[model samples]
Structure formats: structure tokens, C-alpha cells
Target: MVRTPQPGTHSSTDHDPDTPQYEAGAGGWGSLRGVARIFAEARSSPEALRILAGQNKPKGMMCTSCAWAKPAKPHTFEFCENGAKATLWELDQRRADAEFWQSHTLSELRRLHDHDLEKAGRLTDPLRYDPESDRYLPVSWDEAYDEIGRELRALDPTEAVFYSCGHAGLEAAFLFALFARAMGHQNLPQSSNMCHETTSVNLLKYLGSPVGTCTLEDFDHCDAIFFFGQNTGSSSPRFLHVLKDVVDRGGRIVTFNPLRERGLVEFVDPQNLSQMATGRSTPISEEYYQVRPGGDVAVMAGLMKCVLAAEDAGPGTVLDHDFIATETTGYAEAEAAVRAMDWADIEHHSGLTREMIEQAGRIYLSSNRVIGIYGMGLTQHVNGWLNLGMLCNLLLMRGNVGKLGAGVSPVRGHSNVQGQRTVGVGEKSAHMPADKLRELFGIEPPTDDGLNAVHACEALLEGRMKALVTLGGNLVRALPDRTRMEAAWPRLRLTVNIATKPNRSHLVPGQVAYLLPCLGRTDRDVQETGAQAVSMEDSLSNIYGSIGPAKPPGDNVRSEVAIVAGIAKATLPRNPNLRWDDWTADYGRIRDLIAEMFPDDFADFNARMFQPGGFYRGNSARDRVWKTESGRAEFTTPTTLTALGETPDGQDVMTLITLRSNDQFNTTIYGFSDRLRGLEGDRDILLINRDEMSRLGLDEGQPVSLVCAIDDGHERRVDDLKVTPYDIPAGCVGGYYPELNPLVPLGYHERNSQTPAYRGTPVRVVP
Candidate 1:
């Protein structure tokens, strides 16, 4: 069923349009290699100049996340193709603002195509699109803040929801959570819900902690790395540096993914001295296997079965029987279930050979320290929690749970989500109660549970919720069932979004919609008191200060904390006796309150954050003691093995999985198309399997339509879209999210985690 790219798909002169044209560069192994080489060269370049460089910087401002963000002398070519595209994403280009809004009403703006609307570029002013006037009007910050404060003050604290994006920093998030708690609210919906909700839930159950158990420094000491459903070379190019070190040191790296990506095959390390000089690419994966999209749990169970069998056969130095019996529960049950499964069924369902699975198991048995790294690919499945649970099972069996360089790591999307959860931004759970809240903050917090991302959408649609105030993120577009979300916007009493530029969420007109342009991560935030440095919590739960080198975009744009404080001042008047003005003057005062409230983690937040490297929120999982009732890791039993949904009953329909392109982040579309995929200047093309297309009576360049059977049961067909049939598995298709999010059903989500099961959706094709 493997459909590799066709041969002879590239021409020698791809850039020269005057050369004889051929379908040669359409799709093939050669085309894939060419794209990979282009990206590698860009990554290795020393002079990593952004393609969209302009008059903004003093000549040294590069992407902070890119490899070129360091202080070393820049290489000749350092920025990747995607990094250049990301630079274009943040260029000082202007999208039509008050003037364009004046010409078109909110209703008319809603009629424009997604690509066409994005082409309008960045927004410059605070705007309020008026439905009656059929135009967007410029609104003052004072008026907008006043309207938002009044609406928030009117609602019961539980009714208001605060959602965050991946790009937000710890300082802004801390201030946002404080605002909610000050107002006696706890409804916090964030991007973590959609990405790694399962990892947090499952890891907490088994390891007594939610964050990653290992740090980047631990990669140096590891003997084996189980890369479960993560594409390191693409998602985080910096990971290639770590993997290259592992291979150079004779460590084995195993990968379990449906697609054998080129980045994993061989990566030319741009940072390595000898590799960069010689243009030598180091192979990452010693053994790679294609595990079926949702079959990770089953494959992991099989591996655990092999481990237990080996332990029973003979006493070995690798297996720690004493630790297993003392620290973990239900090992015998897990072993029985795994041993009961037939090898044939496991292979058939997992789409992996037994030989390949055995190789992964052998690596685990021989390695002194094993680290499991996973990304959204593992957590976005139907049984994502179970997948994470199995990884914990593997680590627990080998006594690798508590030790350094041996633990589960779920790479996150956002910079500060882990910190936001620490600063009192979550729903009511068993561990976090109202009594604890009263003891910490000196005030009784709300006892009721709040709405999550999914529940917020449902509440908005049912008219149970009246107001929506976003700290940072695109709610309408980021959520599944985009059509219903767009329609639900008008039902709100007020909608306030604090963002950097124009996004699709702004187009969703509320009765009173307000957009407050704010300072970006790279911009300096100056207040009446002085210049301030914001903090960000990294993937390892470490809080560090972030001070931008560049000046603010405009004088009118406010800092996120300032806007939050303004709303708080307007909504909850500072009592002369209680006094809140001092807290707003210095952010350290806020941190002091946070440290007192969460003493277990942030014990000297002010002193620690001032330090150069910042501080780490010490996690007890380093000892491998479960905080659960059992006091040890417990294996969960599933009520149902199969996901409850409409199965493909020989209708020739394929499951569609939408993803973010290399150029784009979450909701921000950096460019029109993905260049690495050989997709030219268009974003609407559907990448299909060549064999599957032929079977469906469709041609390569034919036009087709897609109807969303899941969301609102409406026709979501897009016509005249060119179909580029290429290498894809049968009964499977892929496309970009948000643009194709309307196809996902609202109720289709992971069981325990409430994360959308975006990878597996049954859809029929029309031509």
C-alpha cells in the first residue's frame, strides 16, 4: 500500500522558466531530494539574511527560534526556506485597515475568500467592524476597553473564558490568569487542549507529573531514543543537532511514523564543524517503521509484551524486577493483554513488520537509558492518551521512569502554556480545590468547573455564553467546525482580542468586536514607569526573561500586561484601602503574589526570574512516585478498543488529516503554499494518492469538490481545485488545517483528553 513518489519528476533547470517545460518535476524521489537539499543549504548558510529584509532592524535581528538567533558569526547561508517564509510573515507590510473596513461592512467582509482576505496583509489599527454601516470603523482603546470591562463585570465569573495561543510569553499569561482570578473567574481555554492534552493527562497518572521528564541536556547521556510519531527534522530543526550527536556517539534512534520523511533519512548538520565543512549528512534513524495512524497503543503494548517475556525467560542485568514489583501496579495484567494479542493482528493493524518491531524492542532491552520523544502526531489520534500510557509502561518496566536521561517528553507548541497552568489557570480538578485556593490567595476561588475550548464553542452556539475575551489567539478559526464558529460569533455580547496583527478571528463580527493591537515578542514594551522584560516558560517548565532588542512598532500599541491592567482597573476599582496601583507599576509585585499562591513551584519568583538563566519548576516525577490513590503507576483499562465513528464501508472514501505547513504556525498563514511539497503559489490544491485517484476515476490535473459530512451537515465543497496526485497511502489524504477545519466534526475528539481526533475523519470525494 506504500505509494512512493514517481520517478523522473524533476528538470535540471527548475528556476529557468524559458527552458523546455515538462511534467518531469511534478512528483518523485528526485523532487523530494531537491527540496530537502534547498532547505538544508538554507539552514547551513552563515549570512542568514531574511528574504523580506527591510528598514526595520539595525542589520542583526533574526528569528529568535531559528538556528541563526545565536551570537556566533553568521554563516553564508543560515536561514531555511521556511525561516525566510516566516520572516515574510512578520514583515512590516500593511493590510487595509480603517479605510478598507469603511468600504466593506462586516457582512460583506465575511463573503470574501480565505486566501483573498489574507492577501489584504497586516492590520495597523484597533478596529470595530459595524454590521449596520457595512464597514469597519476605527475605535479608541479607551472605548473598547470600557465595553469589554463592562461586559465581563456583568457575567458570572464562570461564564467568561480566556484562551491563549502558543506564541504568548509567561509574563502576559501570568497577568491574564491574575486578571481572571481577580475577577473570580477560572474558565481558561488554551492551545494545549488541542495539541498535547493527552500527554499531560496520561503522564500525570503514571509519573506524578505532567511536563516532560527529560531536558535537552539529557540527550547527551541517552543510549536510545524512541521517536514516537515526531518529525524532528521539520517541526523543530534544532532537534537534528541533538540526534546527530546521538548517532555520532553510537546511540540507536528508532522512529515510528506512517511516513518515512527525508529529514529522518539523512540531515546535513548546519552547525557541526566537520559536517558543515564537508557537506556530510548524518543518518538519524537506525531503524524506522511505519505504524498505522492510530495503532501506536497496540504497537507499544506489543513491545512491552516482548520485554516481559524476555525477563521471564532468564535473569538479566537490564531488567529491574525488584523496582517493577515495588513501584508499579498491574504489570501482570498489562503483560497478559499484550501476550494474548496475535502477532498477525498486531502487524496487520499497525502496518509494521514483526522484524521491525523486534528491532525497536531489542534497542530498548540493550540500552542503558531510553528517552521517548513525541509530538502532535501522537496526541492528535483517537487513542492518543493510551499511546502515551504505553510509553510510560515501557519506561516503568525498565526502571527508567525516575532517572535522568530516561523519561517521556511530549514536545509542546507554545512557549508559556506550562507556566500558565502553574499560575492558576485551569478548571476545577481533584488536586486543585476551592479550599486550597482560599489558603493560597487569601480569597475563596470559584468552586465550579469552567468551560474548555470545546465546551466554550458549544456554549457560544447554544447562547449560554454571552461574552468572549481572548488574551491571545484565534478562537473561531482555531476551533473545529469553522462554519458554526463563524456563525456563533454574532451571538456574543462582546468579543475582545489582544493580538499583534490581523487574523481570521477579527473577521467574525460580534455585537461589539474589539481588536487591540499589542507589542510582538521581538518588540520592547515601555510603560510610564520604565522598560520591562517579559518572562517565558520553556518546554521543560523553566521560566526565563525575554527582553527584545528592537523598538516598539507604534506608540499607540500597548503591552499585553498594560491592557490587562487597564481592564482590571476599569472593571474592579482599586480600593484605596486594599491598594492595587503598586502591583501594576512593577510586575515583580504580581510575581510575589504568584510565588505566595503557588509556593511549591515559584518559591522566590522575583529573585529567580531576575537571574540570567531563570528557574525550573521542580517536578517530583524525578523520583517516580505516583501522586495518585494507588501511590504507584497504574495501567488504565479501555472500555472500547475501537473508536466509535462511521467506519469506511468500502465507499472508496479516505480519511483526511489536516496539518500546519512548514511556513505557517497555528492560524497565521505565512504564505500561499508549502514550497517543500513542490506546491506552487496556491493553497487550495488537494494532495491525493496517484493510485487512489486512478481507482476513483479521477485524473492528476482534474477539478474536484469536498463536502464536509461532519460539521453542521453542510456542503463545504471548493470547486476548480487542481489535484496533485502523489505519494500517499491508500484510504488516506492530507491538507492544511483551519482552511479545511470545517470538515472535522465538533463531537469527534479523544476520550479522556477532549482533544480533537483530527487525524482520522471519514470523507467521500466528489468530481
Candidate 2:
């Protein structure tokens, strides 16, 4: 007898233990313990250990955690703690095979937490959601593709959304984009839209390109490094070694974040036996400023104001007058805007005194070459583009761009997100021009811009988008307005997921849903030609090869490149111009086509990829060659100083900053413990200032609920959140994302970029 599939539900009252503990520092014995725990839980074998050793090394698989640059001369152990977890998680012995899926009902699987779902192991076969049996049943690859193709062909091309995850390698992403554009639509919503879209959108306006200018080697020559809103320890732990080298060489590091992250304060390299044994740690930040949530704009303006004041006092001592005249434009307006900013307004909005801003300004003035680094903290705001404009203004004041050690660095989350965008996986045709597509492949792609993550969600909810085909990532969980998305998921006609494992996104199935299993970063991808290797691009615009060495658990799983080609072949009408079969068999054909598409960057794609440490895809900004309409860099002046314009009065609201746990990467929860924050066995705890807790008459571990202050008629709330006293700014609170994503309305987003405002969401904490 078939059982009824119950609707999936989430209870806000679910709570784990609220005990928060502490450790000495970020990476010492604690990181080692975390690594050991992950290995033990995975029941890792000696072969798994061999695979871990090859991570981040030359010609080996890149770490799937963050897009941090690989070292030119890598150490014996190039991977970090989180990298180890990601590696082992992919190398797990467990399997969610056909029998395993048959044993568990769809409703029962939906009840499992995201961490538990991942721990259930890698998927071994393609699965089709069986409504009569209320379970996922095994299906052949050809059959699954045929059904998906039929469904896709039946609908308008614009009604289908092709979502690309950051985990996809460059070759796979290229094929994914080629297939989407071949269908004559451009509804490609990617993971970049959520995190660093603002960086791309605003950088194009200011620097003529949407790429960071600095390379990994720039750290060696930098005199000072300024961190705007990134948490190096938790997000990109491997980059901490670069900061340590900077400090060891007499350089300075300045941090501006709302929370005093342990990684930023102190760090002990677990690979260093001397430091690990003695517990002697290297202090990371020379000066740390706890700027308010969404206060980066104010802080950046204040720094520029200080620079202008100093320039006025000394005439031509501070600003780079020559660079401004020859290399840039609109300096007069930018300077006027900075000079007009009120000190009181800057202090009120930034949560930093004038003396503090001046002190930071002094550090900037003293350093000859400065690298400005930031993360999602500056991007996931309503005024995120404005924040980047101000940051660009500050860097331009002293000619920071196109310098050896001075440039903008946005630490990306996914392993190959930037690379995906480089290969034309964006909503717009910025990277893929229509004339080039027509001239090279004789195919004319859609001219109109497509939907992003936010618009995709709205389209799905309103029934405008009929189908969703995801390459990877838990899209349902990663996006904001979770309550609405979860409720409206059933409205779609079809959903197809190409992934390595099961997650919440697969649980919320559409009418015709298919879970197509694919090879992971650690799984060997042997194509028709031979053992295949995929390429990836780091945040610094360096492209390298990644060849997985581990064996696959089953032969049913296919390579992402092959899977994308299979769908394309089954769906699109056969054309003599396209060679889908050859491209699937040999990825070199794809690379050759990519070279033809982006000749300037990928002229010798395959050959350059074989070089040691890979080839740099040279940024125009780094070469001092601005490609703007005016043929020079431009300065921008923001109209507002506050990130999220003035909050309403008489509302007991705190700006809630969504954070990721040290044990987590993006939406994939590694474990319940966040050792750096001294939190264990819980992911539903809120971090607030002690004074704010006292003011609310709440004690540590007190259960409370958060309600969005926006009166959008939607009761966006998360209840039963344990309040823990923390060192965050008074008016700011911190909590993990996806759990609190429900409070972030779909309508509330950056105006120009459309990136969700996940960083500075105002919410009222009620007991």
C-alpha cells in the first residue's frame, strides 16, 4: 500500500542546548580536534587520507569550501580544518542508494535536519519522486533525461530557470551555460547573486571591470591589509596564513567588523608543529573596529573625509593628484561629497568615534601599499552598491588600484563561483555577447535580461516560472523568504537537481521531480577519452586544473559536464553547428569553444591550465588599462551615508546580521558545534550584547523570538531562539542563516544589484 506524502514543515520552537564554551584560539588543538571528529564520523580509510593529502596541491582537486587562492609553493598540508571536513564529507562511506531511499518515506526524510541529510551519504543513482509510493525510486539516466527534456520542451524557454551552484567546475559551468543559452532564454540564476553580486555590479561602474585586481602574491609586498567586513578565520581559514606572513614581515593588519571573531584576534596554524605544541599563536589584527551592521558606508566615508582633511591641510601630501588627473575622472565631485559628510552623522551611523576613524585613517596614510579585503558583510545590504562605491572612492583617493600590493579583494564563498561567471553563467549577457555567440556558434541567445535569485523565487511563487533545473546547491535553503518559497515550491511543474548528495531542496519536490546524482570533487571523472580533469578559477582570477583521485561508489553517477550535455542533447533540436556528443566525450572541445568565445582571457585555455600554479587570467584593472566608455577609471559619490536608511523611531529593533558557524560552509551544516564562537551542539542560538540583554530583561540562554520590523503584512518570524550574551555591538545581534532567512523579505534587497539584504535586517526581539 502506498502512503500519503505529508507536507514538509519547520518548527521555529526547535531548540538545541544553549551552552556556549570557549577555546584558546582559532586553529590550534581545536581545529585538529574538529578534523579528527570529521574523519572519525566518516569512518575514513587510508585511501581517504591519501585523497585529503592531494587537496589544493598542483594538478589535484581544489578544496570545495572557499575560493581562496592556492599558494605558489604549497606546503605538505595545504588544506585547513574546514577543507578537511569538506573533503571527508565528499569521501564518506555512507550511501543514499535505491534501497536506502525506498526504506524512508518522503515525509520522514523531510523531517531530518540538513546536517543529518548530508550525513546520510552520497547519492548513488538517479531518483524520481513517486507520488503513489510517496518515495524516491531509482530510474535510468536516459529515462530521467527524456522525461525532463519532454517537460522542458513543452514549456516556454523563458519559463524554465537554470540555476548554477558555485561547486561546479569551469568545464561543467560552461556546458551548463551553453545549454541554457541554446534554448533561447537567459534565466540563469546563480549562487553569486546572493553573496558578491554587489561587488560585480558596482566594480564595473567604478573600475571598468567586475573582478578583483590583486593576486595572491600581492600579500607579500603589501605594507598594510585592511579588512572591511570579512571573517577570515571562519570563511577562508587558509587565507589566515597569508595574514600571518604579512604581520611577521612587519606589515600591519586592520579589521572592521561588528563581531570580534576569534580567528581575527588570534590564530595558531595547526600544521605548524612548534606553534601547535607550544600553543603560541600569532596575533592577526593590529587594530580591530566593531563597526555597526551595514555601517561600512559610513566608516568608508569617514576615512575618506579624514583623507580629504589631511590633503587640505598639506595641499598635495595625501591624495594622489597625478593618478587622479591621468588615470581617473570625476575626482572633484567625489572629493566634494566626501568633504561635505558631517562628522557627527558619520559617528552616529558608523558606531565609531571620530578619533577611531582618524586612527584608522592614520594607518592608511602611513601604509604605501594597502590591500582592501571584504566579504558578504558589505554586499548583503539594501545600500550594498553604495558601500562598494564609497570603498572605491577611498582606494582611488590614494591610487590603490593597479598597484603591486594595493587592490580590492572580495573573498568569495564557493570554490568556482567567480569562474562560473567568467564562463557566462550570469543572468545578463555581460560576459557572453550576442554577436560573438552568433559569429562563433551560429546561435542567437536571448537579448533580454533574465531573472536573478530573488526574481526567480518571485517567478516561481507567482507561477511565471514553470520549471527549475539546478546544477548543484540547496537553492530552497540558501535563498531568503524561506517561508514563502517552501510554501510555493509545489506550484512548479518540474524540478531537476544534479547534485552529489541529498539536501532540503530535493525534499520539496515539484509535480515532476528528479534527483540526478553526479560525481563530486573527490570522485574520479573518467570520460570517454580518459580520466578527465576540470578547471577552476580562484577569487584572484587564476585558473587551474582539478583532477579527482578518489573512486566513485557506483557507476550510475556521471560527470557534471556529461550530465549537462545529456540534458541539452535530449532537449534542444539537433543542429549541425553544435557538437554535444563530442563535447560530452572530451572536455577539451568545450575548452576550445570557450577559448573562441572569450579570446582575450582564455586564448590558450587548455595549455595554460597545465602550467605550475596555473595561469593568471590577467585583470584589466591590475594592468592600469580601464575598459570603461571613457577609457579611464571613474570615481563615484554615494548620496547616503547610512547603509539601510534611517530606521523608524520608537521601535525596539536590532539589526540582525546572519552568520555562518565555524562548523558550516554556506548552507551545508558540517556539525552542530561552532568552536570559534564557543558554541556547541546548537545552531539556533542568537548572539547579542550583554547590555542589550540586560535592557530586554533577558538572561543568557533565554528563549526568545525575532520579528521582522518591516510591516510588509507578512509575519516573518523565528521563534524559540536562545539569547546568548556576546561581544557584538549594542544595536546589533547575530544568528546563523537559512534559520533566520525567513525574516528577510523577498522584496527587501539591493536596488541595483537585487542581492538580498541578509546582513542588516532590522528585527524586534520579543520574549
**Model 1: how large is the Cα RMSD against the reference?**
6.2
TM-score quality measure for candidate 1: 0.86
Maximum-TM-score candidate: 2
The per-candidate count of clashes, in order, stands at 14, 1
Which runs in model 2 stand beyond 4 Å of their true positions?
Answer: 1-21
lDDT of 1 by residue, 1-767 (tens): 11222221222112223211122211123323433443342242222233323211223233323221111223344343444444434433445556766776656666765545655644556777576775668888788778778878888776677777655655567667656666777677777777787776767777778777776556778899998776554455545656777899998888876544545656775545665566556777887775556656756766876787777787675567787788888777766677777776666555555666776788888997999888877887666777777778778778876787787777666556666666655654332445545665455556567777888888888888777778777778888777777877888877888876666787776777787777765566666566666665656666665555444545577777777777777776464422345655666766776676667877887777644334667767766667756888766543222232445355555666676654466666654545334455666667666667877888877777765545445655545556766444455666777777777777777767778777766666778
TM-scores of the models, in the order given? 0.86, 0.96
Cα displacement (angstroms), candidate 2, residue 8, comes to 46
Candidate number with greatest lDDT: 2
Q: Report the CA-based lDDT of candidate 2 relative to the real structure.
A: 0.86
Clashes of 1: 14
